[model samples]
Every structure is written in structure tokens, then in C-alpha cells.
Target: MENRELILSIKDLQISFKTDSGTVSAVRGVNFELHKGETVAIVGESGSGKSVTTKAVMGLLASNAKIEQGSIYYTWNDFHTGEKKEVDLVKLSEEELQKEIRGQKIAMVFQDPMTSLDPTMTIGKQIMEPMIYHYKKSKKEAYEKAVELLQLVGITDAERRMKNYPHQLSGGMRQRIVIAIALSCDPYVLICDEPTTALDVTIQAKILKLIQDIQKKKDLSVIYITHDLGVVAKVADHINVMYAGKIVETGTTEEIFYDPRHPYTWGLLSSMPDLTTNSDELYTIPGTPPNLVKEIKGDAFARRNQYALNIDYRIDPPMFDVKGSDTHKVASWLMHEKAPKVEMPETLKQRIEAMKRGEEV
Candidate 1:
């Protein structure tokens, strides 16, 4: 594999929200690194902190949300100076983030296009706004670039579509417009929060392919926040399996799909529907996620993990390096040397075998 430069790093990120009842810990010591031109997927159930972590990176957290701890280090080459620069995004003020980082260095494509788009604003103006605001480009220059971006994202009749309002386009076209806007600033990093969730299956596939092609063309580093492993299987170079408020497993795409270590990861993979599955009942993880209002002791996933050990209830497990792989790591007692061997469920094993045979699971 070619060595890639690190573009962003999140270290020990802890975030909480001041709810009416009490403080809810939304993210706990989350850490991940993204390299130039790499796509990293953060996958888990709703409320697992995937979106919160990325929101923190973008300085988009709500007023009640607090970053209790951690650092988000972002590196970029200065355009004028031609020198490397690095900053801790967590420490940047809202003003600094707005003026220097958000939408300029890093852009986000939200899940719902309707919510992201201004129904009253023309699509061309929406796409050109960032360029005009950030770069102080003339209207004519920004207009031409906006049209080009629309074409780049595969929107047909770019000039005409630019004149249409948000309500005038279909769901898929709206999403394409959203992608065009995210790329309008020529950001080095793209954060996609379930970008395809609202679209149909065929549209979902097309959008995923479009993002992949755009990433290659622009050499963009992407962070995808989603619950869909199916989408991760297609676009992710690496995977982080989040449970509760922290990542339970981290590995390269092949390692995660073929030899997932954490029980949470096994459950997630087993729940996915394979083409060969004939059972009427769909598989689901047995229990609901733990409440964030209460303090979590030991492993946050211990209560729901079918393969959990006694130690899982008493103490939190450190990230144990998986044997024979440098990139694979899991937070689970099962990885300890003295712990009894517990393999992933047999059904999941069969599914993995099918996947290895070029079948989708």
C-alpha cells in the first residue's frame, strides 16, 4: 500500500450534552485518523456518537453540547505560503472555524438534502454562495464554477438546473446538488453524514459511486458517518465500529469484514441480510443501547454482548491489538490472553465465507 499523509486526527474526544434531566455523555474518548485520499467509515446504531464526533470536527455542535476533552488535529498546505500548517480544531473558536476551517478546508454533506438546502434560494446561488463569501470571487467567476461543479457531480443540464429551486428537484437530484455544494469550496476533506440514507437503493448506489469517483478526481480524504454496513462495504478503506459512545473495533475493510474481533462488530455483521438468507425473521442485536445519562462502568457493550466475559462487567478493556495485524484493534475482554476463547457466532462465520466467495452479506 502507498503511504499517505495524515490529514486529520481525533484523539480522546469526549463530548456531552446538557439535557434537562442531566448531562448525557454523547461521545467518549473517540479516536481516529484520516489520511489523504482515504475513505474511513464510522458505523454504528443511532445515538452511538458517530455524528456527534464529526459535528465536533466541523464546530457544528449545538449550544448545549460541550467538548469535555480531546483534540482534533488538522493539517493542510497553505495556499500562499506553500508551507505545511496544523491546528487543533477543538480549540478553534467559532469565529476562527467559520472563517478559516468549515466549508473551506473541510465540508460536510448532510443526510437530508431538503433540510440542507434553502427552498427559497436558487440552486446556482446556493452553490456559488460559499465561493463568493469565502474567496470573494466575482459573481461571474463564481457562477461559472458553480455550473462546473454541478456538472462535476453528474447533474444534467447544469445551467438550467442551477436556476431551479430545491423543491423543483427529485430526491436524488437534490442530493447531487448537495454534493456539488460541498465540493464548491474545493475542500480537502469531506464529511458525509449518511449521505444516501434518504435515497432509493439504485440512487444510493449511484451516489456512492459518484462520491468515490469525485474523491479520486480531487484526492479528497472522506469521513463517512453511517449505520449502513452495506454502504461501508462499498466505499470504506477502513472501518470503525462504534458502540455506546466509543469505538469497539477498528480495522482495515477486509480485516473488519472477514475477521471482526469485537462482539458488537459480530452482531452488526450478523444482522446484515445476505442474498442467500431465506429466513423470514431478520436478525437484530438482542438489547437496546445503554442510556447515556447514567455513568457507564466496565465495557459499555458488556450488557448486550452475547460473548461477554465476567471481566467485561467489572472493568473496561483497553484496545487490544489483534494478533498478526497491525491495523486491527478491539476493545473487549475476549482479546485478553487469559480469557477463554470465544469465536464469532457460526452463522456469522458462514456469512463471511459467502462474502469471501464474492457474495454480498
Candidate 2:
């Protein structure tokens, strides 16, 4: 069984994609660690580099994308010695990564289940695919385990679903199959890249619950990549809030939701689709992210940040400590002595106050 004591650790990672136009920096100096069985949500909007960061961890980056810097370390039980030791995954070659870890140890539940599963392959075959490739399990044994996996993922009538193809199942069922495949090998780390993105609200909730249940039961470290704060609130133990190509703020889920110090996070939480609020006019972080091709001389969110102090325009704020546990940190000019004490949005202030009061918000 996987342990909850802590697992993958990614530090100071930088990644950029080489395009014809020039290099587009997708992930820049990202830092976060995933504890064993800990559900760490990488929350950010589209183009925020959440997926790309995890993709670098998986050794799944495209040929054009170069992982410019940083270390990704993993701790696993040594079968022979039965001792735990940290392995530097970033140093592993492409072949070694694919051969030794990838799915067998650290698996990924990709976004868009339909595209992930082969149209030609049956549900059972798709679920069994990873085992065959990594575990070298025989067809019969793999098939039997595949059925059990389907059943484990809450797929009723597993035998029936096993015979069906991706196009045959509903969106929810397809998603379950994706989870089943990711878990077929009982991987230590599960990187779920927006598994609920394409599903409806009802399905999204169900899938989220299913993953939580599985995590509790199997003790899987999950790196959840999504822009949905609702989903993050539901499952995340620790939250890493990403913006542009960097992590602007990070803390426990409660910290991010209640005491969020970053302007971008404020915009996200305030913009939640609450009925009382004007959902018709969703609050957005104004202006665009910095163009990475060109050098970023200042804080990347300076243009969009309503609370950007003058210093933000010229200086890139390093992550500064905040009024919380050591884990809580934010990169903002306001933390500096020279920066102004801009007030947080009233809605966020109210929300934080409500949280402190233990009132229903």
C-alpha cells in the first residue's frame, strides 16, 4: 500500500517550449513537493503551466519542450533491501524513466478521457494496457485484474463495460475507466490533469468523490491539476496556486481559500459561481500575463493585478513568508517594505472573516 508520509518533491524547476517563433517559457522556477498520499492541487487558469509542470515530472514533455532546470525526487520502497531512499527522477534518462517508473510507480490520469483511451480498444484492454507494458503480466492475469479494477472504480457490471469501447460509454464512465487505468498498477503518485474538466457538474462531483474515496482507501499521492477552485476545495490537502508560469501563492487549502494574499487568487475565489453574486459578470484578472519570450523584468501579474504596488513593475518579487505556518507563502510586492498596503477585495475580506467566525459562507 502507498504511504501518506510524503513522496514526490519538485524543486526550482524551469521548463520552456522551443517554437519556430522562439522559446515560450511554460514553467518557470516552480517549487512544490507532494507527500505520500497527499492530495496537492495545482490550481490555475488556462496557460498557467500547471499541466506542464506535472508533465515534466512524468518525463512526458514534448520534443520541443526543454526542461531547463530543477530536481524531481521520488522515494519508493526498495524491493530487495526493503529500505526507503530518495531517487532523483530529473536525472533519469528517457529510457530509464519509461522503463522503471512512469506508470508502474508514478501514473497519470490525463485530461480528456476520450482522447486518452484508444477508440479501437475495449475498456478492459485500455485499462489493462499499462500493466502489460510495465508489469509484464500475462494476458489472462492482466484481464482478470482489469475487470477487478473496473469494479474497483465503481463501474457496475464490469464485465459489460469491459467489452465496450470508449465511444460506447458515457462521459462519467469513460472518466472512471481513465482512473481505473491509472490505478491498475497501484502507483504511488497519481497525477490527475483536470480529470473532471469535460464532465458536467453532477459528474464532476461524483468523479471528485470517487477519487477521494480511492485515495483514502489506497493511500495514493495525487497531484491534482485544475483551474476549478470548487474541486480544489473539495479534495486538496495543500494548494499550490499557479499563475502565468509560476506559483504565486501556496498554502493549505484553507489558507488559500480564506487568507489568500495574492490578487490573482482573490479574483479566482471572488469569481466563483455563487448564486447571490453576479455570476453573469464573472470577475476576471484584468490584462494579460507577461510575454515569456521576452524577458520578464517585473512581477508577471503586475499588469493584471489591481493591487500591484509601483515596485512590482520593476522588480520580480520572490516568495515571501506570510502570517501563517511555514508552508504558507506568497510572491507579491505588498509583502515588501516599500510596497503599499493595498486592501484586499471586500468580497474576499468578507469570506475570510466568515471562515474565521466558522460561519457558513
Candidate 3:
């Protein structure tokens, strides 16, 4: 990945929302980078700030939301001049983002297709609007491209389906249409916010395959915001385990699954349903995430982490490089040299062994 071009870099991002009660710190010093032609999945429980961080990249934060610090640097090549360009997305105005970034250089496919698609508009027109608006293409050209896109997304009878409204299509078909719309202008980066969460398991598999295929065909970088670790095993090249608005662990897919270091990552991996397990009840992480409105003392996840040390309750831990791996990193007092060693649960060890043997766990 070092050789691949860096498409997006987020550094020290801090975001807050003003409520009637007080300000809620939504994102706290979050940092990550996306490379060209790779898929990075951000996984955690709801309200972990996964979607909020990506929304900032697209300039879609709510009016009450404020970015206290940080920069979202985007690097892309100019369409007309073929020159490399880089800009801080946070510094760009809303109008500037609309004209130059959104739907042109970067596009988003939301979780719910029904909400994303306009019920009043025809499918063809909805797909064509981005190209027509961004590239100033003639309606005829846009129409032709729209038909091609419909076919590319695996919708049958492309030209005929273009006339149908959102209600006429099935859930899976509507999601494909949303994907088609996101790719209408050939954007370099695609942010999928739980792209298949609204569909059934079978449909979710198909959508994941479709996105992976399109990524290979288009060489587009992708960011997946999801809580489903099963989905992460299938699609992610790298995984960022976010908890309480901060990334607690980051590593290659293999590292995070087979060599998890952080307690939160262990909890997440342990919660996955194992096929060979004898236990009837499913595992779950204990306790809820801490409220962000109040000032946090020490590690935010300490109250829920069974392996937490005394230092975890008194001081926050910095990101530490894992031993014998360059890609894996974790933030925990247990990673400190002086802290007592802790091991993951035995059941999780067995599950990992099953996975290593090429058996589904």
C-alpha cells in the first residue's frame, strides 16, 4: 500500500454538535488515511463517530455541527488538465464542495436507498443529473450514459427501467440504482455508509460482491462505515476499529482478525457467531459506551473493558505500534511495556484457530 497513491488523509479531527443541554463531542482526534484502489472498513457499535467522520469528508455535516480542528486532505488528478491536485476539504466552502468535490471527485452511497432516491423523479433522470450538472454534458449525452450505467449496474432492460420510478423497483434493485448514481460521474472515491444494512443477508452478499467488482473495474478507493464484522471479513483490506469516537485499533484484515491486540477489538471479534461453538447464547460486550457530553477521564472504554489497568482509568493511552508488525497499531494501557500482560478469551482463540484452518467460524 506504500506504493499506492494516497487519496484521502484525515488528521486530528475533532467535531462537536451543539444541543439544548450542551455541546456533544462527536469526534475526538480521529485519524486515518485512504489509499487508491483499497477498501477500509470502520467498524464499531452505533454512535462511534464512523458516519460523522465520513460526512465531514463529503461536507454534509449538519448545521449545528462544528469542526473544532483537523484537516481532510484530498488528492486527485484534474479531469481537464490532467494535473495532480490536493486540497483541505474542511477549508473548502459548501458551494466550492458542491461544484468541485461532491459527485465529481467523491460520491457517497447511503444505507437506505428509498430515502436517497427521489420518489418524484424517473430513475434515468436521477442517474443522469450528476453528469449533466458536474460535467455540463448535453441531455442527449447524459441519457446515453445513463442507459450504459444501468446496464453496468446489472439492471435488466436498462432503457425501459429508466422510465420507472423508485417505488417500482425492489430493494436490491433500488440499491443498485443508488450505486449507479454514485458512479455516474466516475468519482475516484466512494464512501458507503452501511451500504447493504437495509437488505436481507442474501442481498447483502450480492451488494458486497457488486461493489468489490466495480472497485476493481474502476480502481476507486472505498471507505465502508459499518458495524457488521462479518461484512468486514469479506470486503475490507484494512480495518479501523473505532470506539467512542476514536480509533482504538487499526491493522490489515488478517491482523485484526487473527492477531487482535486491543480489548475492544477482542470484544468485537468474540461477539461474532461461531459455527462450531457449543454455547447457546451469543457473546456480547459488557456495558454501554460512555456519554460524550461529560468530560472523559482517562480511557473512554475503561469502564467497559474487563482487561483495563489502573492507568486506563487515570490516563489516556496513545497509539502504540504492535510488535513484529508495521501495519498493526493499538491504543491501550495493556500495550505499555510496564503494564501486566493480558490474553484474549480461550473461546476466541479457538475460533481464530478454526478460521486459520480455512473453516468458517
Q: So what's the TM-score on candidate 3?
A: 0.99
Per-residue alpha-carbon lDDT of model 2 for 1-361, expressed as tens digits?
A: 1344658888899999988878998898999888876899998888989999998888998999988888898888777899987888889999999988888899998889988889998888888878899889999999999999888889899988889989988999999998999898889889999999899999999999999999989988888999888788889989999987999999999889878888888888887765443337666677776777878878889888767777888988999888647888999878776666777888678766765676553
- Arrange candidates by lDDT, highest first: which order? 3, 1, 2
Query: lDDT of each prediction vs. the true structure?
Result: 0.94, 0.86, 0.95
Q: Which candidate, 1 or 2, would have the higher lDDT against the true structure? A: 1
lDDT of 3 by residue, 1-361 (tens): 6547999999999999999978989999999999999999999999999999999999999999999999999998876899999999999999999999998899999999999999999999999999999999999999999999989889999999999999999999999999999999999999999999999999999999999999999999999999999999999999999999899999999999999999999999989988978999899999999898988899999999999888889998999999999889999989989989888999999999999998987
Clashing pairs in 2: 6-35, 6-36, 7-36
TM-scores of the candidates are 0.99, 0.94, 0.99
| Model 1, residue pairs in steric clash | none
Each candidate's number of clashing pairs is 0, 3, 0
- Distance from true location, Cα of 35 in model 2, Å: 0.6
Better of 2 and 3 by lDDT: 3
Q: Report clash pairs, candidate 3.
A: none
**lDDT value, residue 4 of candidate 2:** 43
**What's the TM for model 2?**
0.94
Error of 1 at 315 (Å): 0.8
